[model samples]
Target: MTHILQIDSSPRLERSHSRALASAFLEQWKPYHPGAIITHRDLVRDPVPYLDATWITAKFTAAAAIALSDELVDEFLAADCYVLSAPMYNFGIPAVLKSYIDYIVRPKRTFAVTENGFKGLITHKKMILVQARGSDFRYGSAYASMNFQEPYLKTVFGFIGITDIEVINANRLNTELRDQELAAARTTIQALAATW
Candidate 1:
């Protein structure tokens, strides 16, 4: 059976578009891929603490850091697939999610520095990012360059060796077509359920 890890980062529950998208995806994906085990980690309710000075010290000392980040790193590696809900906060990912990333992106655990540069310890895993944004940041949009959520995620997860990534964006939620766009996203998710 396939294992899936879902991490939701939104501070809001019902009002979060990203969370809604993730929930819909799960509801739709289950029937297509039966017996798929799923795990949940809510960043809002059980936020990953920020890396303090001692945590930084522990990071450099492999043995010490393992105790601090091992659980998260191990959980991350154990998953065959990931579904992440990433809402834009000031043009980038939320602080909670960033903190979570800092904990899991440890050296030697998720990546290694080698003579050839860097090698990712994680491989052959797939990731799907569900994003919520207020502005229109589509490919050719004026503010497209301002969007950092997907790019940064891809880079970080790619560095850790998860190269197969799909992104779903619920864009322009603060606009007049908020409901329309959300409905469109829902439709897209329904279709994706059958395929992805």
Candidate 2:
């Protein structure tokens, strides 16, 4: 059975737009792929610890010598696909999500630094990010220049070898156009759920 890793990073709980979109997608996806395994990781409820001296040292150490936090790493590696639900905070991803990224982007595990450049060890995996932003950040929008969320996520995930990334942006959540934005997002979610 295919395994899907679902990660929810919004701290707003039930009121979070990204969470709603993610849930909608998952609900549609289940019927399409019966017997698929879904693993949910709620960062707000159980946050991953920040990487410090010990973690950093362990990261550089040889696999035989150090006991890495392999549980999260293993979960990430085992997944055939991923659904990340996040709210844009300060024009970037939430701290809890970033912390989870730090944990999964391991050296020699998820990526390797070759003589030429960095190469991503991960392959053939797809990722879907459901982002809820307070303002419009789509290309050609007035505030697109201020959007660090999508770009940062793309860069970091690309560095780790996940290039087949799709983003479903629910923009302008704090604006007067909130309802319209959500409706559009729901439409997009329905389409992706049908195909993805």
Candidate 3:
């Protein structure tokens, strides 16, 4: 059976665009694959703690000490696909999502430094990033060059072998173009859900 891991990092509930898009995607996707198993991780509700001294020491010392990290990595590795929803905060992703990444991206867990440079242990997975931005940051826009979310997310996930990344950016949410942009994003999400 296909296993899907759905992660939502947006702190907002009713007004969260990214979270709604993610739900819309899932709503459309479920019909296509009815038996797919799904796991939900809401970072806002159950926040993953930032890496502390013990967690840092555990990375190089005893494997057993890294219990939480191991659990996070194992959960990540168990999924065949992932739907990650987050809002761009100060040109980057939310702190909760970043903390979750820190927990999972362990040295010998998700990746490793090998003779060939860096090796990503997690393989053969696809990811859909449902991102909500406050301004117009799409390519060619004046503020496009200022976006730090996409590049950082792709790089970090790519480091762990998830190279097939698709992004659905709902930009200009804080402007008059909010309705138009949100509708366009919904349309895109619906189309992608049918195929991806």
Q: TM-score per candidate, in order?
A: 0.96, 0.95, 0.97
Q: Which should have the higher TM-score, number 2 or number 3?
A: 3
| Candidate 1 deviant stretches above 4 angstroms | none
Model 1: ten consecutive residues of lowest lDDT: 60-69
Cα lDDT tens digits for candidate 3, 43-118: 9989988888877887878556778788888888999999999999999999999999988887877889999899
In model 3, where is the ten-residue run with the lowest total lDDT?
Answer: 60-69
Error of 2 at 141 (Å): 1.0
Q: Could you say which candidate leads in TM-score? A: 3
lDDT of 2 by residue, 1-196 (tens): 8899999999999988999999999998899999999999999998988888767877787544234357788988999899999999998999999999988888888999999999998899999989999888888999899999999998988898999998899988899999999999888888998899
Model 1 per-residue lDDT tens digits across residues 16-124:
9999999999899999999999989888989988998888887887546446478998889889999999899998999999999999998998999999998988988
Identify the runs in model 3 with alpha carbons over 4 angstroms from their true place: none
Q: Global lDDT of each model?
A: 0.90, 0.89, 0.91
Q: Give the TM-score of candidate 1.
A: 0.96
RMSD values, in order shown: 1.1, 1.5, 1.0
**Local error of candidate 1 at 140, Å?**
0.5
Ranking by lDDT: 3, 1, 2
Question: Against the true structure, candidate 2 has what lDDT?
Answer: 0.89
Backbone atom clashes (below 3 Å) for every candidate:
0, 0, 0
